[model samples]
Target: MFLLQVDEEIQIKLLMPKDATALTTVLCANQEHLKTWLPWAVEIPSVSTYEKEIIPSWLQKFADNNGFEAGIFYKNKLVGMAGLHYIDWRNKTTELGY
Candidate 1:
């Protein structure tokens, strides 16, 4: 339940399972625009696909402290997502994905 305020109207919060549909809609609406930065946008088959599979995996990784996926909220609407992928503990590093 972490939350970061980016501004008066923008905030960052962990993406929860319940947010799947909203996130999916955002993704679908911005698919073409997002593809340039996120190749995986084209791979999503449907909204349910993310709700049932992808989001669960993200939550698990967050709980495990191996990674995190947070949603970018603007005016209470899910606009995008950002995250850090598998951390290399020995190297004390991780890759940020948004």
Candidate 2:
């Protein structure tokens, strides 16, 4: 849940409709910043893939208490995105990937 950069006056919160625009902007701006570890990276126009693909998957997982996704916000704007992935509640541990 603690995704903010150290010493940064910002916070990470659940992705909301209001964050869609900023999130899209950052994703585009930082495409290179992400491609190293993110395999699904693509040169997409608009935010449809994120809205149509990423969010849906994250929402379902989060709802089932199997994941937690959030936008990294700096000064009230989304600076990046991160999440907890591959959660295994039964094992008393969740792989924290953010």
Candidate 3:
């Protein structure tokens, strides 16, 4: 999977199915705050949802060379998620989202 080290305390990587529980926990904990800016955060998803659907979809996007959704980890803990929504190959550009 893709992995990047930003600094000593932070890293970014493609999330896998095994990370579902941690991802779900973090998302649910931040649901209210996230809902303020993210419409989809209005409803929190369970770990099973993430494991069976969301993570696989993200992995597929990466495999397709479109773009990818990744987890932001701090001290080995999942803190958030970010992504390059889609890449415009012809334009050599992509949009970022978190």
Candidate 4:
């Protein structure tokens, strides 16, 4: 897991299953504001969704090195996530999705 410190109160690190509840909190809290830009914004209903589906899939992709998802923490709380999806090794290209 990569840990980066942006400032005294902000940090960035890989998102893990253990962070499900926190991630869910961030998502739920910003759902209305995020819904316009994020298609999956309304899909997360609870931590179970993270435990059973979301986190698992993200982990798989990270393991494969195809891409990964990271959490943006502010004051020790998850505030958002940034996803790096589908690295095209041959072309050396990838897109950062947030």
Best by lDDT: 3
Better of 1 and 3 by lDDT: 3
TM-scores of the candidates are 0.87, 0.73, 0.92, 0.86
Off by over 4 Å in 4: none
Judge candidate 4 at residue 28 and give its lDDT: 83
lDDT of 1 by residue, 9-44 (tens): 999999877888898788778888888877777765
Tens-digit lDDT track of model 4 for 15-76: 87789988888788888988888787867668987878888898888889999888899998
Question: What's the ranking of the predictions by TM-score, best on top?
Answer: 3, 1, 4, 2
Q: State model 3's lDDT.
A: 0.94
Each model's Cα RMSD = 1.5, 3.4, 1.1, 1.6
Per-residue lDDT tens digits of candidate 3, residues 1-98? 89999999999999999999998889888888999998889998889999999999999999999999999999999988899999999999999998
List candidate 1 segments past 4 Å from native: none
CA lDDT of 78 in candidate 1? 92
C-alpha lDDT score of every prediction, in listed order: 0.84, 0.70, 0.94, 0.85
Over 4 Å off, model 2: 1-8
Backbone clashes, each candidate: 0, 0, 0, 0
lDDT of 4 at 34: 87
| Pairs of residues at least 3 apart in sequence or in different chains that clash in candidate 3 | none
2 or 3, which is superior by lDDT? 3
